[model samples]
Target chain A: MISRMRILDGTLLALEAEGMRPTAARAAGWRRAVAGCGIDSLETLLPPAGAGDSPDRASPVAESSSPPGNAASRRSAAPERPPSLSELIARVLPTTVVPSVSALANLASGAFPQSGWHCIYGLGDALFADRKTLARSIDSLSEGREALLAPCFTNERGCATALAVEWLLGGEDRAALVSFAGCGGLAALEEVLAALLVHGGLPAADLRGLPELTDRYRRMGGGPIPPAKAVIGEAIFSVESGIHVDGLWKSPDLYELFPPEIVGRERRIIMGKHSGKRAVLVKCGALGLPVTADLAERVLQKVKEESARRKTSLCDTDFIALYSTCRAGKDEKEEGGRAVL
Target chain B: MRFCKIVDTTLRDGEQAPGHAFSLDDKVFLASLLDGAGVYQIEAGVPAMGRDEQDAVCAVKDACKTAVVSTWNRLTEEDVRASVACHPDIIHLCLPVSERHITRKLRTTQAALLRQFSRVAEYAAGRGYRVTAGFEDASRAEVPFLLQAAETAKRHGIERIRLSDTLGMLRPSSAALLVRTAREVGLPVEMHAHNDLGMALANSAIAVLAGAGFIDTTLLGIGERAGNCGLGAFVAACREYTAISPLQARKAERLALPLLSRCRQRKFFT
Candidate 1:
């Protein structure tokens, strides 16, 4: 079995790092949406002080003359357990995927509260146990109705991929915990999501809003996304090679498996050292300066040499400058021909 | 399990990091260090970049005593000429097997790429040079073409097949399948993985488990974009399978940390 489907949003804790605070009303709505989407828990790093945790939200006790607020305060003062996000999420949802960065017995027990969590999320080899011992415990945990053993991962070697290997060995009942870009942050979330969709483990349409989530993190002071970060990189779809351009013009799928539109990106072809003459011809056509076949070769040679010297792709401005030079030479030749006539 | 050979490419692909160039001394230092760590091969550098690069590749071949020296080349005669200039132990020839690399990168079709590799492999092999044919992005290549490319190389006397996850898109399951399939063609397989999807170390490890005969790595996994598998980390993760004593792995970690930090100016996790 694929285990009961649930996507616990772990972004709340990462949001705290960016100094963004969720208002009480927003928190209540967010929690409601998460629950509605079948996510069993809100995996926040810090205890959520959201409206979902407000005393007014929980059902009130009977036989109390005091106002609902006073009775709620009285009950809060004599709590049976310390405040925990896992408990908070469990109260509203059917299942929780608790965050356990460590393997402390106290933390594990608290994170995986009885009759609440659907699974435990942590780095693969949660306590550095060998594969055999780990598999045994995972099997034991999964015995209950819809209890999943999810191994969390970052970009660290043997991260999610290693967990996947173990999961395949252990069977599909196991789950995987991963951030969008393979880290706790939102950057590269969409790209990583795309990879997962392509990797054949999850339904592509089931995933939503990786780019939007990443944007939210950036707005919260997480900083701009790394331009070359694997999947979501700015340059991932951009190509400059003549052959790439030729194939891309024929079919984008020829080079990249998924459409850039999958992640809200577009294809681009810039002129560079590895560029072919077709690229030059295309650029010239775009500029409305149709080049003769001979001129195309000369322009392409110049572009390649200059890109090599610069050790980078030529910017549009550089291409324009080259066009201007060629255009001026052509104009002068035409004038000389007129004078000869 | 086959005893996997370790080929460190820190000086080659690692140096290809955008806007980064390593001096001769840095190349010599890394080559010697990897050699001391018992790496079976060191892909020193790309001699085809220029004469200076060729000279540096030559210098690396001379600097290391234990590890066999090699240079990376594309499936072209000019590049083979450059590798010839270096006079190294193995001429590592590369051909793009995926439709993307063949059509876009080389502007050639699969048939053309196969034809080119046959001629290039023959040229290098007939010269009495030890040749290793790398199917760049073999993970994305059509299965039939990949097998055909391997068979052609095998026919041309290529000694090894380097199956690279060029885009780093390979998963452990697919990696095992690809490596196993390539082995059937009768050539030893090497796993050259990228960390594009953050799966390099894991993919390499799984490939080793699946019977690939060599694992490609770079120190700190520093290369283009995310980088290749880190030598120290790969050694640490597969220490038992690779047969290095824990003490030796620890020593390698110690030597790699300082140089890696100096190279990239960050506290790299690997």
Candidate 2:
């Protein structure tokens, strides 16, 4: 049978109850015994001397806190020591209950091994209902440059709300990263977490609010950006039924969590079935087309009709030629290069 | 400085080159050849490319003994999952880090792209598989973006970050600078040079000198477009630059030439 060790039932219990370590408790008792009225000698604190000692010898005061030639000290120091478990739990519990979950996280990672103490912090299981406790936990966790891993529960509700709030407060990088098990219920949230996990963790510097933060997270998550997955959605970026390719090229801060350089690719406006002159003019002008809007529109109409007949997207060369003719200021009625209008 | 891993992507990217095809026998033969050549890694192919590619990757998986076999993927979870079926020691996912490409092709922001890449990287890492992130077309990517990608990959627990000159646009000096930058960004760098400018070998040399531990190459420099730098040239160059005894370098140099000849005979000439 496996033996259970209890640290609370021994003489060490009173000391432990006062939040003192076993070694400290022993030293305190030894000091008291040494100074006491009746028990002036350290021997009073120690077990009785046995055959191992000379009969006429006076026991050393220094040896009193230490176990003598008896079974007591061995049992006390053994892994199965009675009060160890409870003492350990007590020590850990208080630290774990610290409002700063972030610090607790650092302790777990052994990041601050020199701290000489592993803090006891809350698991956030029951404390989620308490905002003050939750806030405290977040503060504790975010205190140092330590990383935090959010422990996921059944509903996955606690971390999601906490993280969302943290992001809004510009605490995205400092917030605990939700565990991967939480990915399915909150796809978007998990996407953010997944991205963070993938890229290792967000750089503490570039972290920001929801749209930008989530956008950054989604890229690292490596889940296929669905056609409609918020900022990364194919549709969110592409212009629909319009000519402008849209948006500034650099300074992702304005665009929300991105510049195009994240991928070795660029945007190209492709004229298609729904092409119009204004759309053509806008695309060409944005990309530096020299053509008039009216002429560009006429050519775009013809190109659209041709693409519809052929059931294919307009090729780059075709679009280029059409744009070139319009920009060349050709007459609308000219035979070879006339604008379709 | 303590450990250097030279990964050969001959089988994977080489196959992607036009006019290059390898049968099963060819794969086993090449893998055995690579093993004897002391390559630390061999990227077989993207497993999900097709049944044949997957089978080839599996065959490589079974054949390679001394080298860690790996496969390629996009920075996506599905790609990683599919690539795992081949049982490689590593899965290499490519992400584009240049602003032009990110804006024009992906139409997404770098911040977002990085997030996606990180998620997939961690997922792959969590599965107990070594993961390497390839910054495709890294030669043209802005310095800040490239450094960020490298740093990000390091944080995500990737085994290495490969800076690929997808268009083979970098010179040796530039390649060296990038490799050094990658090291400064705190990443184990790998160089994937193409011969688009006929300087693939030169660039590969620069990468190594700049602290790149891995260099992607093909047998006899066989890859896309102008092909990659000749592997033979690289081994020979290392023999010259490394701080080893001249006698040892001479022997290595001599051995590499014959090995190069044999590889060409079997892989191309034959």
Candidate 3:
């Protein structure tokens, strides 16, 4: 079902903007990851030729093969450089068997040939426009051609993700322009995919490859993803509050809309200042530790004190140590009472 | 121009986030920044946490020149008494409205819970304090019961009714419906959104569009789970729908960086 929707990802462009060299290997890896996530296309906007210090040195083609000679003398002989962007795209395009490759161009410029490139219009004040106005804009600019409306992430009007999803849900057969992890202020590929699945009735498996894609994104210098980011945050499934833990224990549907396994994640119970005795007992049970009423109470008290003192949640090691200490204390008190008896 | 009041809870709910413990100085500084950013209200803290917390709340109250200062409390006389000692501009009493929270968490029936809420709101109002009733987890509550609870708040002379999406489980459509339903009670509705689903900003924006008068926010969206709706993000997202000034938004954005730096310096996420 996701094949019916078109998604254009601009992760390579984002990487280049972050000062990472746009190598053939990085592009190929990105293509594989995007394809694995069921995305339709990969979009990149390379720097204009001759913009970098040494176009030849930065070119992936040059990196692959060069005539054996003194590099300085060769450069001095002819200071001409090939169209590196075209060469890089050509090299990377052949490897993407699933998703097609496209170039990025600004809607205002109208210079780049629109045959194989996606034109992006900046949604400035239009972000606050009603659905009718936005539809008219999309239809007028698209003009029977595929046009991708990109939101100005710096615009103080609204959220880029919400705008993109609104457009996608409202438009008919309109392609979405996004970037992995929402880099470069474009809509995030993962978040949009999750929204489509939730709102558009797309198949759940469409998002099953997120955990792997997340790993690849980080490996490709996409920076650390926020742990609480929507749909793909690593710690989104982790619960800590007393009421929430108890509710999830009673019925997961009471708290979670979808199971964590839908995104290849698992539920985690965190012990912190807000944790209660029920959480301690559940955590102890999960860890295969013996739990008594008094022990659970004492351990919870210790957890709250320690988490408050450290200003952070307790790790498994810290929880285990506290449990052991409480158990030992209980044993000591019992022994002292026996001596008195 | 339509105006949506901004209530910044960075010092209260934001500090409830795991790994985030703001000292009195941090609370005072953040409160001043939020006030400078033109927030209408600041939920300082829970005074019942002890003398230190009460002192922090008072310091934030003193530091704010424009914003109204408020304190969060449970539906109990003891909590209200503690809040009164702080002398905040408003006292907010949180009552659980959902069946799951009321019966399972609080172990009480809906009627009993409503009675308790009425008693607490009346008690706080009788003390000559402006009182607000917060319906914790109202997103999951039955619409009829939620409306009834809203009526009870209005009957008690409560100034406002806050609908808290405690679990952050609402999408835009559901959020709009909840806000619309709550607005029918003829009392001002405030939306306190959480970001567990990453839709807090979207939900808050929709709530404003759906006739809610107040929106709750925290700096950098820091709160218990994913966090509350972010002050900067919400202002940016709802600028068209709300009367929040662009200058104030820029000021809030500018202050957010230093708050982030402070959190980073303290290694809040570590």
Candidate 4:
């Protein structure tokens, strides 16, 4: 029944934290891409002076504007008395920006100044805690205020997204703080969105822009996206094994969770050591080549042998060459059988 | 927290990916690393492929000191006979349990498939092999049929049941429900999660939390299409839920880095 939700993407902050300074142009592209995916807002970590660019200059969707220099430097400069939340809010209010503060549950004890801002309470070690304890902790922290729970683990281990989705499903309706590709130890924005779209009644069109967004992310100096990466990997739609290819041929829904077109990808049949006759037939049909069962079997055998020897799937050129050889062999066999008769 | 067994399938299912073909040496080396990292079992390879694959499985079994070596097989006597030649500690039989896989892919009815599985399970069990049933495409299966398959496994002395999310279609809630329901049959459930929708790791962890006894993993999540759950990431993710030692998890992560780097340098992933 939860309807109202917001997604705060932290891809820009994640890039900066990884020591890659994204240009204003790249930032603008990133913003446009995410906006197309229906993201509510973008979160950027304000870099120090002369950091080469500013997200405010890049896009108007960025909601927070903090003082220059990282959080660590600011905290170290006034170690004797750290700036309170109210003091930081006062500084951010002059710029007409509602400050967004991220803090752990332990540090988020006191309350004050009901200003128009959101506080992201980090789940920290409580993410590893048992379900009951974790739920109690979440309820206690966001009991009376507009607090968004942030599932921040140390790495992109599996739990952050699951924790975020669980909170979104079972906990109260609230904004979720996530990062693209799960950078900066936050829940992955793509995964959370996909989950909501598929299981939580969100629009399927919300994810059609993931492929372009991923490409833009790579151009922004993000690390190489693993081909097997969930939601956005290029190779995810490629089918190789016999059972999978057969299942997909019968019905894509049988073997696929969602259609590839939903994420702007196409289904591909790859010829490999595990390729079956059905896969070869499907590939041939897609290539606009007509073939009988006999030809398909011969071509399939050759495809398997060559793929096993090469230790990789065959390209279309390789398959076409193998098909020609098999066709010639079949023709010779037919001529011999006719002569014998 | 319950201790979930780690079943490293890097040499078997991980090799099924298009670009990966591990040599005999690579198999043994990876098996040794997994053993040193305290993995509960290693699914070495499918023996029905030929002598080279059998030799690789045998080599891995000989190289590992603590981890048990297992072989993957289809539900048939021929596949079981091939696995027996490798002398693996466990024989895993993969069964397609979903209606689509049962009627369409397998071209058989549910009862017939289960009958085939029963005959094969009895054969493997009679050979003094520890048999495990892998319900392939179990996520799309009906709950009652899945439980029936689990019951059949238990009846035939099958050691464990592997619930495979073959299409990586499960969310955490569904994964937890599947694991809990399977646990009701009084058999240890192992999760074989795929990452097509990018929820493999999350589903695997949630399965563990929901009473699954084992989780399957690959070195860098390499497998068919998107891949299976990653070994290093899964260990790191389930640290609080499972009794895996932190030191052992660190060792696995450290070994995995160089191995992954080597694979990357060799252009295995393209």
For model 1, residues B1-270, the per-residue Cα lDDT tens digits are 446778888877765543234566667877877877888999988777667678888889899888999999978889999999899999999887887777766778888778888899889987889999988878898899899999999899999999988767776767878999899998999999876665677778878877888999887676655568877778776776675553554576577666554433211111
Q: Which regions in candidate 2 have their CA more than 4 angstroms from the true location?
A: A1-341, B1-4, B240-270
Q: Score chain A of model 4 by TM-score against the reference chain A.
A: 0.78
Give TM-score, chain B, model 2: 0.86
Clashes of each: 2, 61, 0, 1
Model 3 chain B is weakest, by summed lDDT over 10 consecutive residues, at B261-270
* DockQ of each model vs. true complex: 0.22, 0.01, 0.31, 0.46
Winner on DockQ (2 vs 3): 3
Candidate 3 structure quality by residue, lDDT tens digits, A56-170: 6453323322111111112323224432322222222211111111111123333322333332333523334454654544455456553333322312343556556665665
Which parts of model 4 have CA positions greater than 4 angstroms off?
A: A19-21, A38-117, A124-127, A146-156, A332-341, B50-52, B240-270
Give the alpha-carbon lDDT of every model.
0.61, 0.50, 0.69, 0.72
Off by over 4 Å in 3: A1-3, A17-22, A38-120, A124-127, A136-158, A337-341, B48-52, B76-78, B96-116, B138-142, B169-177, B236-270
- Cα deviation of A52 in candidate 3 (Å)? 9.3
RMSD of candidate 3 to true structure, Å: 7.5
**Model 2 lDDT per residue over B17-63, tens place:** 32234555566667766766767788887775556567878888888
Of the two candidates 1 and 4, the one with more favorable TM-score, higher being better, is 4
Alpha-carbon shift of residue B84 in model 2 (angstroms): 1.1
Q: Estimate each model's TM-score.
A: 0.70, 0.41, 0.77, 0.84
Per-residue accuracy of model 4 over B26-142 as CA lDDT, tens digit each: 788888888888889999998987787899999999999999999999888999999999999999999988998888777899999999999999999999999999999888899
Clashing pairs in 1: A243-B104, A244-B104
> By descending TM-score, how would the candidates be arranged?
4, 3, 1, 2
